[model samples]
Target: MAIEPLAIGVCSWSLQVKNVAELKVFLDRLGIDVVQIACGDPHHAAWDEGDAMPAAARAAGFRMSGAMLGFPGEDYTTPQTIERTGGFGDPATRAERTERFKWALSRTKELGLADLMLHAGFIPAVGAPERKAFLDTLAQVSDLALRAGVTVAFETGQESSTLLRRTLDDLKCPNLKINFDPANMLLYDNDDPIQAIELLAPDIRSVHVKDANRPSTKGVWGEEVPLGRGQTDTRRFIQTLKKAGYRGPLCIEREAGTQSERFHDIEYGVHFLRECLAG
Candidate 1:
């Protein structure tokens, strides 16, 4: 099969800019036009004002690939902390999160976005009551997204691909999909990214082109390195993505490093990914 060229994009927040103008300056310098817009953080002042994500991306002359939402209180400081405080899996926060997701659905439509992405938290093991509840929460989110005529691509990494596949199958929601992050699998010790791309190919609607190492200690957070600098084999990773027929933006995400440091890494990463794609 002929390999499709993936759009070189980046998660807007990864640039850590103060505004869209700053982001545009950096994106222009980096030669990137696609952006996964950031939205739905109740804590974010710009998001709280609404319509900021799409407007900003448009003003910046970016192709808004999609929007990513984060719950108000997710603590990603450590694996254990996230298991307790991340995603919509927790019943204590599910109701509130559902409302937030519903708002996001409306905002997505208003912004004319095709879809949005979010972390659904750690899906409990099959047959666990926690699993059932988590599924229900996601189901509700799916309903809202579908009704709004958009997809919700759940981010990978907190759970195994097998379990994620099973959960999606169990729900049988058409609007739900995957934002495959290869680095996350290695970081979270969930599954190998190449293996996951094969397993979840049909459902992957977007991709994160970040790279990372496995956690130093199980249950601890892993170190996120610059692209091609970590264990995420870029050669096999992109090859598998092309072979699997995924046609989506390879959204670069750099969650670590200083502003200048991150910008420099992203610049190098864009070149590295393009070189890999060329071959």
Candidate 2:
């Protein structure tokens, strides 16, 4: 079997540098050919301004890869967190989140980015009205995303694979997709990342090439380890992606460590993914 060359990108959040020019230099030094800019500055709103991505992107020979939509909202796992973030339980707060998501959708289009990776609210507990509200709001936001011609993908973390699959099914929008993050499942103890990939293969639109150590001690989230150093079997994961016909960019993200460490992880992950795809 032969694997065609695929673009390898790292999430800019890992670089921990706010300036796009500095980020380009850092990624260039790490030999990263592509990058996913995850700008979280509320004031910049680069996605909305169409100026968040500096001109250096072209000069540096890197692509705008994608945008990881980050906003202050419910973390997608616990309903209480949703309430804390002014979602689900609060009607007034829910409206605010909706407007924010709309801004993100518009921002994504303004930036000429193709996808907006985010957490689609939370999965409420059984018999909870919050669950209904979350689904209802999701449908509305999804409609906006569809009209914008940009994909709004839910990151795979905080919820079970089944929950995410069901939510995606219910959204019923062509632009709705999944940004599978294997390490998140490990960190949250949601499910086996590999198995999740198998079951949700058809909807996997993007992959986060980060790794994690499964929880060994009690009450601890899985540790974020360097690519191939954690419990994630990235080679098998890539094989699964190939088998499932996922042709999207493998966006590498390092959620922990210093600037130098994150760059190292990106380097390791990009090379490992390429070799795995080739094999």
| Clash number for each model | 0, 0
lDDT tens per residue, model 2, 82-157 = 3355333346566776677777666566555768887664566546766777777777777777787877778787
Among the numbered candidates, top TM-score falls to 1
Clashing pairs in 2: none
Give the distance in Å from residue 257's predicted Cα in candidate 2 to where it truly belongs: 0.8
Instruction: List residue ranges in candidate 2 displaced over 4 A.
Output: 1-5, 42-60, 73-92, 125-128, 217-219
> Which ranges of candidate 1 are over 4 A from the true structure?
1-5, 40-53
C-alpha RMSD of each candidate structure in angstroms: 2.8, 4.1
Model 2, position 228, has a per-residue lDDT of 86
TM-score of 2: 0.85
